[model samples]
Target: MTIFTLSLFSNPLYSQVAVIVHATNQQALTESDIKNLFTGKLKSFPDGNPVIVLNLPEGDPNQSLFNQKVLGRSDAQVKAFWSKLMFTGKGTPPKEVTAEEMIKLVSENPSTIGIVDSAAVSDKVRVLIQH
Candidate 1:
């Protein structure tokens, strides 16, 4: 399959996504862990390693799918959620990156977690969740 790195400008294609971590990452993530990671609730892995989270732009298909299926939030809701957290100084949001950058970032950072189209799963990263 092709490595899925479609630009964020593209329309939502309803494709599945894989939540990935660095290949050396050995965490067995629960659904709660996935949600907490994306939602800014869980800031670090259980071992106290900082969990650096990444995201595709809001309109990206994989971003939408992951937010809906995993985080149970729409783009608007997610935006507002982060906004409130930022304003309240409660939490910081994931950095928005292009799909290609996401793969590159996760590949390079053992502490990072990112979402990409399922078809994009590669040797550079390991899938923690697929939907």
Candidate 2:
């Protein structure tokens, strides 16, 4: 039983993460959409609604995972990318918030979207995609 318990704890399948948006948002997003939004490539939903993107504060585990899985970039790389964009007046990075704050903010704004650990997801937001 101890060995079985250890195996369960070590399983990679447990590390599920989700991309979320306000429950009222009806736009369906693919992996590319999520990547583009987070990377400052796509500024609006496919339906033409303006988007508000949120990120977990730097060094947070969920932020790391989302950056790796969705953006295919590291935290430092993301920062550098945003810095260049900001310096050039080309684009702005997403707003950073705590995981708890993200839940509340995304829930309140119909145009907002964010990524969070699957365990933090609740009924207030809709799961747009899982990674």
Candidate 3:
């Protein structure tokens, strides 16, 4: 399974992932900030506004890359982490949506942040970083 997963990511088409937010957000984020947001470490933007993290549904290739590259965890590990957080009432995981839906959500909501395949980024959303 690990070999197959590695091979899927080895494809050049999936080589880059972009972190994005509403164009109006205007907040610069480092990779660490992004990791914090997704892991429930940093709950709000630096300016104090609340944030909503978005993720592609489990098992999506882009989602796998985002989890591994950004969050440093596998899909099941992320799920278990969030489950524990939710069980203890410490935090909730990012809401899951399809890629198309993620674009729409991030474009419509200033506080919504997500990652997507670099090729899918559009004018509606601003790229914070590419990895």
lDDT by residue (45-79, candidate 2, tens digit) is 99999999999899987788888888889889999
Taking the tens digit of each residue's C-alpha lDDT, what string does model 1 give over 44-96? 99888999999999799789888889989898999999999999999888999
lDDT of 2: 0.90
Q: What are the models' TM-scores?
A: 0.87, 0.89, 0.87
By lDDT, the better pick of 1 and 3 is 3
| Candidate 3 displacement at residue 102 in angstroms | 0.8
Best by TM-score: 2
Q: Which should have the higher TM-score, number 1 or number 2?
A: 2
Which parts of model 1 have CA positions greater than 4 angstroms off? Answer: 1-14
Q: Residues 1-131, candidate 3, lDDT per residue (tens digit)?
A: 69979889777655788899998999978889999999999989988999999988889888888888888998999999999999999999888899999899999999999988899999999999887
Worst 10 residues of 2 by lDDT: 9-18
